[model samples]
Target: GYILSYNGGNIVNAKTGEKLFAQFLPDEVIPILYRYAKEKNHALLGYAGNEIITEMPDDQYVKEESRINKMNIRKVENLFEALEPHPTKLLMTGDPADMLKAENELSEILGDRMDIFRSAPFFLELVPKGIDKAKSLLRLLSKINLTPADMIAFGDGYNDLSMLKLAGMGVAMQNAAPEVRAEADYITLSNEEDGIAAALEHFCKRIFKSKRLKFRMWFKYGLKAQKLLAQGI
Candidate 1:
């Protein structure tokens, strides 16, 4: 098993702690992000390797986020200096209104060097271009001798859009964003109602009843299924 963290900026072996892949922000972009955060008074969090670095340690929003995510908060006086040359991802959180503004401005400021998007209403994420869940999953699948067609993906967030589309079976929860549901192959119950379990059961039953012997055989052997629950953090 493997874990794709920071929206696939980093992939690691779930059992052995071995790094399968990692993509960090370019050295040039770190200063840009830091300058933007400082000038805008936005709370910024940097994911550098395994550490979470931030400048606003006492900011209420940052404190709440750390508590909720159980993140070890490393408060730095200067994030750009702390992270320097190798930060994997950056997350900016604040009022949704401010986030929207930041998203728009950063999109133009960073241009094509990075991908900037709102993972949540109040949270904006920045990662290197070409790094996303689907792309990293493809890399992992190739190493394991499997294809996207062999996988089942589930998601509900905007960031999950690509992964949902790339999988052979894309299941969206009832509570998913409208865009997500529209792109899914099937819609299941909401997460609170055990949506993932419901979708798996329905597919398993259908596979058993249908004439698709290939899928049945694969299931009987060992289905190479991939499940992604986007936290939208």
Candidate 2:
């Protein structure tokens, strides 16, 4: 009965969809990222999607921002001064080669308290400490009197891994990364083949299947029964 949104950086719920749950980057982490952006001569963008975007004409991308043309671009000489209001998400653009150096600087500031994901060649997403899709899902589940074990999650990306693993059944798309596939409870067809629906159907079929009686080999029978079963006895 709730709308789960990730755009606000964490799980958020609002009937109008314009409201954010107020989850934001850690106060300390923001300055480090902003400082890095400044030193690298990079452009920093706060994802206040509702302010700039209207409709998603397609399923994959945010195309509405293009219609509005120029966004509310701001120049911040102070670097860290811009985030005083604390936006929903943080995105930074810079030379791809400098990503490691910038990341290392952030790490030095806060260790593993923040996550900087390379979502694109030139773009990095900054998420604060103790904030992630899975953690937020857990909170939501608590409200509904459900647990992670009661959920069946599907995904194909690295960011989706945490949520997938937390679910009772983690279904990985066939096109998912190799590490993602390894962590999945089951692997389904690629998205092009309607993988989500196919996997759901398969799950239903398995769930409703009748049990078959089979021989139960006892350890007392030892090697003989094991050998017989191995020989299709």
Candidate 3:
């Protein structure tokens, strides 16, 4: 089994805890991010390995993130130094309006080199280009000789749009964003109502019935072909 995290920026073996694939922000971009954080007075958190590193120990955003993720927040004098070498992703936290503005500015600044998007109203994430759930899932599928047609994806956020589109059947929760719901093949109950389980149960039954019908049709056509061949037609 594999776990795809950081919006597919990192893929790891579930049991062994070994990374099968990973992407990182460019080394030069770190300083630019830090400078922007300072200029905008936003708290930036660097995600490297299992740690969340930041310079603002007392920032409300940082504290809230620590509590939400249930991970220890490491404070350092210099975020750049603490995240030496590279980081998998960066999170900029501030007011929703400020983050929205930052997203547009960073998109122009980074161009095609990086992917900048919002995971929440006040959380903007910066990651390497082409790092998303669909792309990463494709890579993993190729390793096992599978394809997107074999996948059934479920999602609720904007970030999940690509993955939902790429799968054979895309399921959106009732609470999913409007855009997400529009793109999904099916919509199920909200997360609070065991949406995933409900979808699996519904789709699984239909899949089995469809497979049985296809098999019967194949058998019918196959017998006709065999009879024609036997009769020298």
Clashes of each: 0, 0, 0
Clashing pairs for model 2 are none
Candidate 3 segments whose C-alpha is farther than 4 A from its true place:
56-70, 205-233
TM-score of each: 0.77, 0.63, 0.78
Model 2, 10-93: lDDT tens digits are 554556554334476667667666666666666665544443321112311223222323454433334355344665567665
Candidates arranged by lDDT, highest first: 3, 1, 2
Error of 2 at 172 (Å): 1.5
Best by lDDT: 3
lDDT of 1 by residue, 106-184 (tens): 9998868988997667778889888889999999999999999999998877888999999999999898889999999
**Whole-model Cα lDDT of every candidate shown, in order:** 0.84, 0.63, 0.87
The 10-residue segment of model 1 with minimum total lDDT is: 224-233
**Each candidate's root-mean-square deviation in Å?**
11.7, 9.4, 4.6
